[model samples]
Target: MAKLIRSIVVSAPSGTGKSTICRRLLAACPDIKFSVSLTSRTPRPNEINGKDYHFISHEDFQRRIDEGEFVEWVENYGQFYGTSVKVINDALNHGKDLLLDIEPRGAKAIKKQFPDAVFVFVLPPSPDELLKRLKKRGHESEEAIKIRFSQSNSELKEVLWYDYTIFNEDLETAVFQMISIYHAEKCKTNRLCGKIDRVFKI
Candidate 1:
């Protein structure tokens, strides 16, 4: 009997430090696999293709979308982002715990297809704090920052539907909470059912 495999989808508004928390969790748990998403946007400095994202042209992205190659996809800030259906199936087939860092729209799309998957949201302590963090990035224009700030407000409302939420006031504490959530999810009845059945048969 094969045990159930689950994917964890996590999201946070930009500048909330969600990616840092995810990286820490991955470092702490080597067995978990991060699902690198496909994007039509150009890679930022230090971002590696296939590692950070599968960077592709807009035409290529739209072609895949037309072919139904993605489990979920969305266009944001004029860039396309998507998760391939193969990526999810491959990880589950190999018994890996898949982790996805995506936006609220993509996460909601995933939830429909993967009802058993755990959904988590990372949030800033306050709107003011989030704005401050966005400014500290030192790259975006003021208008860009304002747009993201508005988007964050909209995304924050989506948190109410998530399975769990973590406050990112402190990185260490947030990571601890995320890891703990992972451990707890691993022990859910749906996940353990196959093993329990096998033990009884023995």
Candidate 2:
């Protein structure tokens, strides 16, 4: 099948299985490219600077913000995260399918520009379950987890407007749902109209 250039924006609160789901989805559909975000925060021990995120100095991040090089940016936990305008533009311009793993703020910004893009919200089994998962992650302090758990309610509210929501109760099932979503999006009539024309309409 001819793959149509598409954009997938997946957003979820911290500690949710959004990252894991995205990883599995990418592994299953290796052709789709992931849009690495830019962050002013220090990289975690296992994360690679260019792959996980474009880690940069606060001063440089501020300069880029001043230059309007980002499509959107949001500050969380005393650090900044952003999506590059050039990165996304080049992908769509070159007919590449792109997956963006970002927070709701960045996802909303992308939606304004790419109205046709599919926006998915990943959810934990429940709010209480999410809090437990966050605590278990051990990536943040107790105070930070409290703040994030509180903000999670607001993030969850964004799901009201999202195209789909995947309840990540089971890892394997969730990955399958994510992959199914991507394939279904690829087959959407609007997305495949041109590609179909070349294959059969002629």
Candidate 3:
């Protein structure tokens, strides 16, 4: 039997350094691949089309939904975002772990289909610290910052449902924690049963 490929789903409020941590984790683990999400929203200033997100038209996104091509999808702030089933299945079939950067709602959707996936929630040390980081970015107006700050509280509530929660106070520490989780999950009895059975000749 082929080895089981586990997936990691990470969700965090904006400015929690989730992306930075994910990048570092990917660099440290070559066998893991980041799952690129498809979004109907336009790309941000520093964002790349295929690298950051697969930008698609609202019409196209809706069509994909009707075709059942997405494993999980959600509409947030009047924009659609989804994870492609094909992309995730392909990685798993190749025996590669997949790292998904998704929001709470989408994560819930994915959980229904992939209950064994490791769900992690990243958080800031404090609400004030999160606000400070958002303001430092200077990418949005005061009003926009306020909106994100308010929304963050609701997002934080979802952490209780996640399997693991990591505070992004220190980038290196947070990345190390994530990598540790990945390695630990791979060693679970269910994941290693095939190897164990072969070794015991049972």
lDDT of 2 by residue, 51-155 (tens): 989999999999999999998899987899999998888877877889999899888898998888889999999989999999998888899999999999999
lDDT for 75 (candidate 1): 86
Write down the worst ten-residue block by lDDT for model 3. 1-10
Q: List the residue pairs that clash in candidate 2.
A: none
**93-168, model 3: which lDDT tens digit per residue?**
8888899999999999989988988999999999999999999988789998998899899999999999999999
Model 1: ten consecutive residues of lowest lDDT = 1-10
Q: Which whole-number lDDT from 0 to 100 does residue 174 have in model 3?
A: 95
**Colliding residue pairs in candidate 1:** none
Descending-lDDT candidate ranking: 3, 1, 2
Instruction: Give per-residue lDDT, candidate 2, residue 64.
Output: 99
lDDT of 2: 0.89
Q: How many steric overlaps are in each model, in order? A: 0, 0, 0
Output the lDDT of residue 33, model 1: 89
Cα miss at 70, model 3 (Å)? Answer: 1.3
